[model samples]
Target: MEEEHKFIIRTYSKAELAHLYNPDMPLVSAMRKLRQWIRRNKQLSSALAEAGENKRDHSYPPLQVRLITRYLGEP
Candidate 1:
């Protein structure tokens, strides 16, 4: 009798998730864009931030928000 091997998939890290979602894009560039967007759209950013800070089950703001906020001052 031959023994069969089973393979298990592992979850991605934060960096891995980012790269997988946006391949070929520099991490820094992606973050910058996200921040910029957040700065421009304060309401959205605030909502998302609140959700996260409060530990609510809500999706995060788009990556553009993170990128935009990083480069530009928050609104």
Candidate 2:
């Protein structure tokens, strides 16, 4: 018999996301930098690709917190 592995995906609320980026900075600016960080880091492309699979809204694509942590090395 073969064993199957399951992974849990984590999603962050706006407040949590902002804190992860920078608790000392403004939330709006933190989010902007987070987006820019994602764009510049090509290694994070796989994480974004996974996010695309479960995207709910076209205007606001969902980002996986676990994947972000994996690539970004946690907050």
Candidate 3:
């Protein structure tokens, strides 16, 4: 039998999530990098848009966060 750990999904501000992905980088730089990653990922971008996500929004809803984690793998 294989054990599968479930990841908890939650809302996160863009900066917070970005920092989780890049702890060593400055917050602003991490944010920029996170934005680039999202922008460059077509599927994630469209999914976010379809879920009513605004590019300028400061936070991600739980659903959007899940989508991001799915594509980018837990950051």
Candidate 4:
């Protein structure tokens, strides 16, 4: 019998995240701003640091998701 594995994977791409952040803004511009915001926010930076490089460079972890939702308004 094969082993079974289950887990929830949560990640948003640049385009998706951009749209989530601001639908009215241009995609490239929004993405740039989002990156800057992630780097500038203390709570977000710390969360990213704790989550490590994988979660930092690639996608937002669960903690970051909560923070983003709280701060950025339901992204």
Best by lDDT: 3
Higher lDDT: candidate 2 or 4?
4
Global lDDT of each candidate: 0.45, 0.62, 0.91, 0.65
For model 3, residues 1-75, the per-residue Cα lDDT tens digits are 999766568888999989988999999999999999999999999999999999789999899999999999985
Better of 1 and 4 by TM-score: 4
Q: Kindly list the per-residue Cα lDDT of model 1 for residues 33-72, writing each as its tens digit.
A: 5445545777756654654532242233445334323444
Give the TM-scores of the predictions, in the order they appear: 0.37, 0.62, 0.87, 0.62
* Counted clashes in each candidate structure: 21, 0, 0, 0
| lDDT score, candidate 2 | 0.62
- Residue 45, model 2: lDDT of 59
| Residues 1-75 of candidate 2: C-alpha lDDT, one tens digit per residue | 999644334556645665666878887788777767777887785567756733342222235666676777666
- Rank by lDDT, highest first: 3, 4, 2, 1
Judge candidate 3 against the unseen true structure and give its global Cα lDDT, from 0 to 1: 0.91
Model 4: clashing residue pairs?
Answer: none
lDDT of 4: 0.65
Cand. 2 TM to true fold:
0.62
What would the TM-score be for candidate 4 when compared with the true structure? 0.62
Worst 10 contiguous positions by lDDT, candidate 1: 53-62
* Each prediction's RMSD to truth: 12.6, 9.0, 3.9, 9.0
